[model samples]
Target chain A: MKRILATLLACVLLLSCMSFAAAEDKKTLTVWIPQYQFSKAEDAISDQDFWDGVFDPFEVENNCEVKVEIVGWGIYGDTFFTSLVNEDGPDLVYVTDNYDLVKRDLLLGLDPYLTQEQKDNVILWNTAPENANGEKVIVPMDDGVAIGYVNKALLKEAGLDELPVEWDAFIEACKTIQEKTGKRAFLQNWGATSGTSALMLAFWPYYFQAGGKMLNDQGEIDINNEAGLKTVEFLKSLLDAGIFTEDIVTESESVDKFAAGEVAYIVADLNKGNSAFTPAGIDWEYVFSLKGPAGYGARTATDSFAVNKKTVARGNDELAVKALMYITSGAVMDEFHSKIFYLPPFTKDASFVKDEALYALTSAHSEDVYVVEEFSAKKSFEDTLLANIQEMFQGNLEPQEVLTETMDYYNTQLKEN
Target chain B: MQKTFFSRRRRQALIGGAYILPSFVLMFIFNVSPIFLSIFYSFTKYDMTAAPVWVGLDNYIKLSQNKYLGNVLTNTVQYVLITVPIQTILSLLIAAFIAGSLKNRYGSFLRSVIFIPVIASLIASAAVWDTMYKPDGGLINQFINLFGAPSVNFLGKKPTALPSVAAVSIWKSTGYYMVIYYAGIMNVSTEVQEAAIVDGASPIQRFWYITLPILKPITYMIVTLGIIGSFQVFDLVYKMTGGGPGRATLTVAYMIYSYAFQDKRMGYACALAVGLLVVILLIHLIQTLFFKERDAK
Candidate 1:
């Protein structure tokens, strides 16, 4: 009888071991990203090291293993959406822009996963709203805004001690720089209809300067008044002055020229300035939107992340939320920003602004930093306006004509939608 | 005897069917199915994340209204019209020259060298071309500058970007077409060439009268291939200019990619793609009909 009991006990132990192994295997979570953070030893050490350090600690603390799958950036957008639709998606993904989450129902909402206290801790500006189905799909990983970068040396050469503080002064400064340095003064990415998007970044500051709002609370097109026309005229005058690069609509061509010091000032996303200028060892300074006649500084555009509601409903909510919080947390962001020289979205104290150039710009423009509303009613209208602006830059349409055409387009879109 | 004869015929038919089964199955699964699916999707709106919604002819209607589509279509036609004829003529000339003059071994070596790009991966060749087309540091610009020409933003300017991309496509495919023509030249009977030489016909005159007319079939083949290839041109444009300098290099395929992948307008993209396919098919049909008539005459 004792021998029989011993055999039964051994069988029970073997069965339990098999079940435990299966359970462990079932707990595996998959994360997808564009590229492996570290492919080269040096790149691994300098850039990807922080991701490993952050995730490794989190894994140990959470008692879960995380698997990462690297996809090429070129194909990631299509592949990620396709995988999500199939319900064979990853637990976490890195998205380049917030529109990816807002436009597609690919992410999970984190509301149910996080405690009220935890939700409250997140920056309000970074929180993405749910769709009609009520899913808070994405968490903003970084704050990206378009800003102007001025070459300090060029400004000094042009006998300017301080950067331009007003619209008129800005234009004069550009002219002075052009005359003195024989270099293109203002350069922007402009080419096709999409080039209009970059121009809108610069256009926003002028709109604010002219006391014109782009959209009202209801998200109607509001740039139909005198303020809007003034903004258009200002853009035209700049173009006429030959201050902007000839290839204003092209991507990165003008920015590249600026980086090579062929242009004195460039309008680009803050992230681009950080990446191109800082790494290339070009001495540059960020300029806040110059105060126009109305003395208002326009806010730059904001892109964020969202969670997919479908993923949340599948009981992966907690893990996904935790991953979102971890990536967006001040510490992880600070590491990413410092390494890549990107501007962090988190509130900056004296300690946060360690880089002198970054500190000076952020501190000075702290109150002026405006966030573009992520959800706009007239999104399509905004796209049309952008295209018209490109036409203006191309000299195919006069600025006034383009603005009028844009107003008509916006009116039509508003009526249709 | 009747039973034996019937059984033998049936067995022969079965053997022939068995020989083609693998190829037929593979083609159906890989090629035919995808084509049909694409056609079906073209009539629907598929955003990749949700079920496709049927929109019928709406996508085609929208395509007609799209101004950018018109521009890209024009660009594509220009590319086909210019690159096809020049590439065919250049390849034929080089093939004829090599076939007439060069030693057999040297000719083969030279042909191989020229065809190296044909075998080289499109992405790799595009990367090399990207450097060569760079406005500031590209080899093309340097050569132009050496000739006392001003620097031109070949890929950055709208007027030049499409032509520039076309030039690269021509350069890469020229040798492949040349090899095809070379084969055609080789097949020309030696007796005919010897007779032409004995009649004291000049090389150019002999080539024009004898070689050119005889190579009509090869020319037709090249034209068909060029039309299909040029319309499907995506990878090189994607890698090099990304249809940029403000949609200057935008082709139908690239537009479909942007709509499907970037904008998530899969239905619209599919419609655009289907439209392109139809256009290509129509062109091919017209060309075939005309060429067949010409050959018949």
Candidate 2:
């Protein structure tokens, strides 16, 4: 019995040592991707399956292990902050606005790793090498415009030949539709829990359309001036005209109503527009941002792949950058865009968008669509601004008060940041 | 003999210490260390990514100038006032009635039923309540419409949002407190109740005079726990309102979460957290003094 026990213990120790040796043979690269609408293919069985299909070949080629986690939007901030604070963050992540991360030096610069062709071919947005304090910290992944969706059936019922391209004409069309069809017109979602949906759809596009600059030369928020007040007053006019109501500030039921043809127009981004309207089988057309007093403007969304500096700490910086580049390559992104919804890919030649009309309209207005300045105070400013606008819609605050209060909060928070 | 006795006592003490050493070490690492670190971090500007810069009193000064601080504090106090008293009284009454009149199988089944919400997930409960409070075709709105009344956006209006969230918290918590009170009441002496009955005391009188006094310690404990719990409310408000409709339901805890996580203002959030700790400590001290005074009287 003693001999048998000794033999068994020896065998167990040997197996444990072998397992540890095997683990040490290959390095593990951790990646966290926030849950986007098109992060996975529609027909894929699960996120794990989709990511496995994308990463298996790369892992084999690199002779390393790739571990991926799909994080939800709601807890993404908390998860990333806590993990990075403990020095246990993933090697790479998808970041839309990297200002906060860059300010803290949490991201690894990708400029040293990028090939000249990658740099020249990819259309970088705000995080270009020249713009990011001379450190290229992100590789552009997808681009989208803040545009409105018009239900063609509803427009036909309302006796409009085409969706209005100008703000005044759009307002007139909405009012005429409300009067004739007795259906609500022009709904913007204010209650989206994440991503400052209201500010993107209802506020910033209009503010820019009215010729407002988000920041001044001194890097101060400059939205409390005439253009800001005008945007607020325009929204207030909508409230007074019964185009918006207290219900609009509640959780979003706008897309559902629009698909049901109870509403004629609703503002949405590319992914949300296609995924929502196409599946509902609604005859909807994209309306490039309505031209306003300053000509025309829309909010553009650009997200990128960011490598964490923790990759360098782990001695896998090159491996992580290689993986990021592979993921953002033209072929991979084209497949990704075609499988889900259409967003303009980073590479000029990568065009797999199924919706050509949307592609053309978005491209035509691409120069007019602008993303807000990258700053640490963006989230706080957007949240408070949304709340203040909601108050204005409730008739609790005047337009000037909304602008003043929002800017006050933003400037104060910006100082802390 | 004296030396032997002392040695035996020392041995016993050593054994006890050995038994408690593991838990003490764990507590020190996880709980005690974090408390001290939080206090230290409150005095510095630390974003967790870089070395903390000593910025004495800056975070605190910013707190004083924060325009939203007063509103969040008022909301938190209002939430505590609304939830704690109502839940305490309701749980106490229900527990007492069950013990006195319906101490049968039906009572046991009813207790189990009432305890259901205590076991349900807060997120799930809040989500259900949010849907039910929706303005368009929600359960409550649909029922109200039966009487030919217009739909009311219960959570969209500032006046109704906080109270609506409070209602959900009360619903979720009353059961847990009810169970505690039920156990406390079960431990009450039957002989005392019989003695009061022999003196020709009525049900109400016996309850007021005997059972209530016996449950005083339990009541104090329940109220203290309730106050702390209510003051630190986050999940219900987070799921229900997200501090929306123009900051109507913003609480201090949610604000701290937003700052620490969303805004990455760790030092400011730590200052806020330390302030919350002091407030809770003062509240507990006051509650203890009140209970002691009542006992002395």
Cα lDDT tens digits for candidate 2, B218-254: 8998999999999999998888777878888889999
Candidate 1 residue lDDT tens string, A110-130: 666776655655555344556
Looking at model 2 chain B, report the run of 10 residues with the lowest lDDT sum: B257-266
TM-score for every candidate vs. truth? 0.84, 0.94
Q: How does residue B87 of candidate 2 score in lDDT?
A: 92
Clashing residue pairs in all predictions, respectively, total 15, 0
Itemize residue pairs with steric clashes in candidate 2. Answer: none
Off-target runs (Cα >4 Å) in candidate 2 are A1-23, A37-42, A129-133
DockQ of 1: 0.26
Estimate candidate 2's alpha-carbon lDDT, on a 0 to 1 scale. 0.81
Best by lDDT: 2
In candidate 1, position A248 carries an lDDT of: 56
lDDT of 2 at A201: 78
